[model samples]
Target: MTDDADSGADASATDGSGADADGDRLDVGFVPAEVPGAGLTGAVETSALLVEHLSRRHDLTVYVASQHAADDVDLPAEDRVEYVIHDDLPKLPHPITAKHRALREETDALESHDLVHSYSSVFVPVLADLSTPTISTLNSYVAVCPKGDMRYHGKRTCSGPGPAKCVACVGVTGARRRQGLENEARSAYSSLGKLPLVRDSMARRNGVDAYHALSPHLAEDYAALDFPAERTRVIPHFYDGGFRRDPRTTAGDPVTLLYVGGLREFKGVQVLVRGLAELRSRGVDARLRVAGAGPYGDRIKRLVGELGLADAVAWHGYVDHDDLPDLYAGADAFVYPGLIDEPFGRVLLEALAAGTPVVASDVGSTDYIVGDAGERFESGDERALADAVERLVADYEERAGAIPDQLARFEPETVLAQFDELYRDVATGRLRRESRPSSASSPTPSR
Candidate 1:
């Protein structure tokens, strides 16, 4: 793929010839290995906005390729939301990357869509196979590196991800090395002059029309990957139900703090645990709640026990998305201390949308997502984290004052408008070459 920022990284898309000839009746479908749920909401939510909008506004039919059984999700379905399932992929124990079922479903589908909106990087090849116009989102580094997190042996710097390095890192970390092998294979396959079917993921990423970035910080990552700066766009994630539905209520006597994501080393859950332990020892009346399961669950549990914080920390493992709203309502503050550079950090958006103030690591896309709405401290500094927590928990007025108004930031209406403008401009052949800090909203969100 091209690397020049002037052309390759800056998307210069005009409404395609197909769109000009026949776009009103185009079948705009969203193809993902799985419909956005579980722990990944950033890419899923953004794709849903496009899917939901195309279904509601344009005369388009949205088909969902679900890897699961014939069962349909209970989430609200529009007349446009259709489902297509496959029999090839098994729906048992191993379920991290739904790419296998995605390939099968796309290859065997009886129908064709006018345009394909892909959430998973693996499905880009399938779109190419079907001769469908596709825009793929680079959700993670699974497309480019061995470890899906792009984090090297618990360190932030993305290291040499070759076989020797990957295997050695996996051996030391004690995490599963087999999946890393598969990822290495996938990355190697893509690097060889880009496959026609699978190459669209990189092709569109380098210069696609109306693209989405979770935050300005994340946009920088995409820019580094050679995504056209003009094509790159920022859209903060929002909950399924628009932000206005949930009424915010204050917490009870015990100040509640929550962490809700993968419990691995990169998530920095251990840092939050250590900080909370220190808070207790320092005479703070606070409680820690964790609601996610991962390979590091046992390790986090062991660490909590070792730190003597078992009683103060409650482990409500693997809370589904449906139950998250109530969890947010019950909590006073949300914390996500990710050790790696988070692409979008949907947890921060969800917490703020629920009116639960948050404290996040000042790394990756946290600052952009926070937008001065909450507190951010250095990534691994437990004392700084503790200090931020205490500041938020100290007085009622202080917490209220500290939480910058986040309602507008996470509102779907607000983000969708920005998307509509970008898409219209792309479709109608308008180009704004300026990349960062656009005049639109100042384009600055903290760090």
Candidate 2:
């Protein structure tokens, strides 16, 4: 891990204008350890965007704790933004409890910062024990739900986290006998560890000063997790202007249905393949193009073959982040068939910004984020997904026109203002510090 002085110096050098020298400049530290996926995860991108927007005036430092090599992720280096790669930390076992294994050494690294923002729920307890005020961003459901996606054994979405429900769900879904047992044991352990009293005790020990949710649905989840509703704010994720583009006018025949994201069961790529097959069975000319890769690649491909969609499906294999906007712009519509309760679909926002209409499953924050600009169907309902795809393809002109209104809410400036207010409130004591009450600090973990 890089020392604070080195990081501070690097940030100071980047801010050539010396804006960070101001007396009121806030020193903000960001921890993104529990970020999921491999290359350019949503949490990583959000951290980059936050630095880009917040560094103009604040002294910014990002502590990236990940299982993957630090070089794989990139961050903005302008306006006093320094990204510290904490690559020494090992990957946590279960996605949910990963947050609970926060290293004391890492926590001590943030002792000098004025305020720290942790995007990992596992570190909420550790952050609570620090002198620095802290805020946590609920980017996903792992903090509360052990399955992370809130999908019950890969079958369908569930109401919320529960030990019995999670155990039964994992027992049915887990592939191998030993794997199922492990999942059940881990699920029960994580669920019980997150009890109200346990979570409250963690929070009282300098836990989180505030909670930031990407959607109202997530804010509701936070409230259920015992976080103070008044201290929790629903701040949507911001979109980088790099995704903006002109809407495609020359729509193509065998209308291309695009799917961009991890090719996982919960991601529902198989559902998209099934939906496209249904469209073909009805004699409707349609094709599907998937631009991301995952462990489910072979399984998804096998399903496509089983459905006789070999000629209708195109695999683009993990499209680069910069190239996604163009891909969205070229497609007739972006289909997000995710079967789980997605905390927030950043890709849906990217589709809208790129002037492409979205067709997603009616789960999680899709309804809240997409609003009328996109189409939604029941989760895992292939027939309904096919219908939405056919409808959007037919009315491309009308659906594409809603892009502007849909993209307005995620405008970078507007979202940045909300974040700035929260930061200033915390920095200047306008917001209550009760969320991060003082406690006896913990010592750094030995290397």
lDDT by residue for model 2 (364-402), tens: 899877877778998788999999987777777777777
lDDT of 2: 0.70
Error at 331, model 2, angstroms? 0.5
Q: Mark the regions of model 1 whose C-alpha exceeds 4 Å error after superposition.
A: 1-26, 36-54, 63-66, 70-72, 75-78, 87-114, 125-133, 159-210, 242-252, 395-404, 425-447
- Candidate 1 local lDDT, 1-447, one digit each (tens): 111211211122223322223343344556543553312445555555456544443334444444444344432245656655442344332232244444444442313553455565555334333333344555665544445565666465663245556555545444432325555354344332222322344543432344555567766665666667676667665544532224334555577899988766678888999999878878887799999887667778988999988788998987766688778757888987877886777777777766677788888877767655567788988888998887666543544443445555655445545644544554343632222121233212211
Error (Å) of candidate 1 at residue 314 is: 1.9
Q: Model-by-model lDDT, in order? A: 0.57, 0.70
TM-score of each: 0.73, 0.82
Clashes of each: 3, 5
Clashing pairs in 1: 9-228, 10-228, 125-197
